[model samples]
Target chain A: MSFSKEITIAKSSVPKVALLVLATIFAFGIFEVGFDQGQLFSIVFGEQAYADLYIHELTHDMRHAAGFPCH
Target chain B: MSLFITIILLSGCSAGVIHGLVNLALVEPYLDKAIGIENQHMFASGEAKDTSQFWAEYYSYRAWQKGGQLLAGAILGTAIGALFGIVFGYAKNILPGNSFAKKALALAAIMWITLYLIPFAKYPANPPTVGDPETILLRQMLYVSFIAISGFGALGFYQVFRRLKSKRFVAVLGYAGFIATVFVVMPQNPDAITAPADLVNGFRAVSLVGVSAFWLSVGLIFGVLWQKLQPDRVKQARFQ
Candidate 1:
């Protein structure tokens, strides 16, 4: 297939798109749990202490439950 | 093709379960101690109101927490294994000499070394109570940059080795030199870890052990499964 035709075919493939979406979600989830330190949403909204604390508290139990290295 | 993906996912899930169980049995005690220490510090600093109540709750929810850890491990493992499967599939097409099992094991070892061991040693994970909150972003950036450097550096070394195939000793020396350069040039962590030395060491050791167990299991299970599922492939690999 030509390069453009290949691109078109890939873009039209539902399974490919679904897999891409799933992979993206999985990567984001890993980043949030493993590296974000529970400040992901708050970080996107600028540095808001209350928001960060709120999100952290909300995820605190889950983090600990998952055995993440949270304090 | 789907069968291959299923095998990868199953292998990864098994690895993840092993990882979680290992953590629960061997590493959880040290981790609990570290958490207790952090909470004690928070209480002493007036950041927490009731450490006793917190400990009681923590103990009470032990079973639930263990279950959650296992579930998280399985999910994460499946995702990671799927990615690994895709990469290995592509790589096998390009590089055909080795068996799938050997390739998977090699990739697993390289990943364990570069992605986890080196980067983690440089910027070990700290408890939330350990570092200054303001420096969290900078710390994370530094940590991630180190991971990138380590990963890309390893790949670069492999490329160079492939290019200089005739001089294997020189290639080995070149890779060693590159690693030494990275060790020296990588920026030191600016923020001092505030956790007690013992606690920090204990936590790092436990975490490393858990991760090592996970990767080892992933490598072994995937290798065995791939070999079993494709006996013809194994025969080809032997001839190669």
Candidate 2:
């Protein structure tokens, strides 16, 4: 058998809209885990009137776990 | 097979989360004490709540936070680990036989150094009370940019090494030069450390331990799983 395996980058097998949606979800996930400090969603949605400490506290451990510097 | 890979990655992440939680439990008292000391003035001046009441609320919050951390770890691990698994699977073709775990561990070590240690040495993680709330975004951006630069720099070094396989001496010099330049050019945070020294040291120790445990567990578990699930790949690797 040959040692080298052929590798190729294929065009989208799924619809453009679906891919876009998936990309958006991935980006949001990254933001929530990495950048948000738990307030990104609320800030984006203009929910300044309400305080949600739960998400922040929950993600605090995660930030430390991922070494994102949650101090 | 893809689903199997995802499951394996998730399991590895679960192990990582368990290790992290245990480390947190071991270090929790010291951390609580540090936080209390750092904020004692606030409590005394009525700026912060009482320590007893705070601990009660904090422990309860942490009990729930455990579940969130596990979920987040699972999601993040599966996403990143899937990509890692694919690349490692391909790399198996080029490596010697029965060395998958060793190679994986090597990669994990490098990742730990470049991704966390280097950036962290420059700008250590501060606790919730350390910095201005407004500057949180800027601090996070700076830290992440450091991680990105280190990661790409490591990858570039590997590429350069491969391209100059005929001249090992030149490759070594080139890599050293590149790394030195990165160290010189990487921006430094000039902010003074205002937190108590012991508190900062305790937090840094625990945080590093937790992250190191997670990465080590992920690498070992994933490597073993991949080896067992795809023995044929290993056999092929031996001949190559």
Candidate 3:
């Protein structure tokens, strides 16, 4: 499809996608910090690991909400 | 139920691939760089016949070692984001228009990053014993660049979904799937995880988060710069 059409569609959908991304971030964040389940938390980054894998997931969500793939 | 199961399995596969690459190939070298111990000897330590395990162990160690700042950043980002979401509760407040420019810029950035904007070091750590170090690092750089760029690509995909009649639940599914895969699939134990690191020793803590934060900030900063550089024609379209 034309670039213009994609933009128009993206513009129209921005709010919804952004909202969803925001919600997902919130849900995961709260769960990770508030609950702090040892088994799940440790496993997520790998042993001796300390990353919040959800960062990628949240970025993925941001892409989702933005309306199109980067490529 | 069947469809959900299939989706779950597929998600796991994607995440598993992402996990191995991030930890082993990326994290290992960075940790070694930080501690001045980057080398390929660690990969030779065990039966890590596969490169995947090497990378996973490297990343896990760094992740476990994160300092207080990153922990605070992640926590802060989550809290602030949630508060913003709550304050801007209405759907209308979600996104802006004329997103093409932002997307186009994002695409251009990814492409450029894939080609350039990558990391290099004084010495090769993992410097795989079998392959030439230069060739190994080049291939690793390309792979990581692709993965980083893929982040924007995934977002663009979601944009299309919203344009299509806009199914709320499907979007939610996308988010849930992403979160579950990332949070649950990463390795917890450096030794237990099958991956091996080319680096000589364990790295400082929280290197994983540092890597992502650096990249994400790059995206955000690039996004901001693009927003500034963009002509009024594009910016005006967003509001129209």
Each prediction's total of clashing residue pairs, residues at least 3 apart in sequence or on different chains, is 0, 3, 39
DockQ of each: 0.09, 0.20, 0.06
Q: Write the per-residue lDDT of candidate 1 for residues B177-200, one digit (tens) a residue.
A: 776687778787666777678776
Question: How do all the candidates rank in terms of DockQ, highest first?
Answer: 2, 1, 3
Per-residue lDDT tens digits of candidate 2, residues A2-55?
Answer: 464533222213234433443454455555656664366566545651366545
Residue-wise C-alpha lDDT for candidate 2, range B31-134, written one tens digit per residue = 45555565686778887786688878867876766566666655555544544444454454433345557766665676677777877787776544466565
Candidate 3 lDDT (Cα, whole model)? 0.35
Candidate 1 local Cα displacement, residue B240, angstroms: 26
**Residue clash pairs of candidate 1:** none
What DockQ was computed for model 2? Answer: 0.20
Error of 1 at B153 (Å): 2.2
Best by TM-score: 2
Task: Estimate TM-scores for all models.
Answer: 0.72, 0.74, 0.27
TM-score of chain B of each: 0.79, 0.77, 0.30
Of 2 and 3, which scores higher on TM-score? 2
Tens-place lDDT digits, model 3, residues A1-71: 22331221222222455555555655565444323324354665565333454433222212111111211
Residue B32 of model 1, lDDT score: 65
